[model samples]
Target: MKRREALEKKKSIEELIKNANDPLKDHLNSLPCSYRHYNRNGLSVYLESGIGSNLSSFKKQYIQKLLKVNMEAAYGPKEWVFEEKVKRKEMVAPDARYVFVREIVDNEDGMQPPGDSFVGFLQYRFVLEEEMPVAYVYELQLEQCVQGKGLGKFLMQLVERIAYEYRMSAVMLTVQKGNVFAMDFYVSQLRFVVSSNSPSRMGFNTSYEILYKAVDCEAKEK
Candidate 1:
């Protein structure tokens, strides 16, 4: 679908909110997959379950479902987008890891879902890109109601933080050029640079752009 048409049909799920819900992380602790926490820019979030290769069947299905929901919500009826690839990677890739993100509710003084409330999720793995190890973000999707909030930045920060923690050189991700919103979000908002090896950059008319942020060594030096 064209970018203009996609923007026209776009609707935020926040329209369904009956009461005010802050799109930031909750203040609870010790939830499932809670590996790290962040308080940058007055926004808080947690890293849960640094699972490797052995993601449960239930989690795999849920991630696929969420991915489909996000894709359809963005570009209309993307029924064939995310499933087989997610399954194959999550079930077998030795370096694959899942990072589930949740929005915390301060009023309840507890987590929203199994650990915290489920607002969004991310999947990534360590891989060699251009002869250097980097954390590659396979997917990052958040609920519509939480879109404009700072949570997306927080999640990307998590990916970079993980990369630095593991001594990886950077964090990489793929975004469709047709996805104007995401392209802007990643480039303008998150400050990711397109890789020189990306398809379009290499003169091929491609659907996506490979973007990366240098982390680890550079991050630690400063």
Candidate 2:
């Protein structure tokens, strides 16, 4: 009787676990989209987009799912509870990092808005050495709605434009094969040169490609 009872209990727990996963899967599939626009004057910059309060929740859920374990399993029981607080600390509004809402201008007047607005953005990190400036795009995100509308290309070109103004010697970025659309865009549309020699540190196992566009920003003007 004891053995039979234990088997029934195990079956009930399995059913519960399966049922709980369905809703979470659906939530991820239908994540919401919030778009904005941005611009920086002359200097290369990181553009943040996709802002909303739910960004925190999204990150927590994403980390949980990626581990494929409940919070307790991932961080251990007591540790997990405390770790939740740390996770909240790491939370950022999706758009806070990339939005340039301050640049928007009101149609009623020539005045710019108090902050920049971005529909999507590419984040360029520029490093200056001596007289040379090299910029790398650490992140790029397209508003889900604005994606597939050529906004990605427009945003990328905007980065190069900023690099030109900053007198950057070169601009570069990396794209993994899983994101084939981005790879194609960088190679074909922007005319970025793909590096054949070195593998990427982060995506070593994947078909990650590094690309760069050299700018003779210091070249003497004729």
Scored by TM-score, the top model is 1
Error of 2 at 171 (Å): 1.2
* Per-residue error (Å), model 1, residue 205: 0.7
Candidate 1 deviant stretches above 4 angstroms:
1-46, 73-92, 105-116, 216-222
TM for candidate 1 is: 0.68
| Residue lDDT tens for model 2, 1-222 | 998987785565444333322322321123222122323342122333333243445444543342234234534678767766654443342322222312344466664453333333344445532233455565565444445655566566666655565445566776665566667888788888765323663446645677777767342220
Model 2 error, position 169 (Å): 1.1
Q: In terms of TM-score, how similar is model 2 to the real structure? A: 0.45
Candidate 1 residue 222 Cα shift, in angstroms, is: 19
Candidate 2, residue 192: Cα displacement in angstroms equals 0.9
**Who wins the lDDT comparison?**
1
For each candidate, the alpha-carbon lDDT, in order, equals: 0.63, 0.48
Candidate 1 lDDT tens digits, 61-101: 66767776777555444434564455545644655566676
Worst lDDT run of 10 residues, candidate 1, spans 13-22
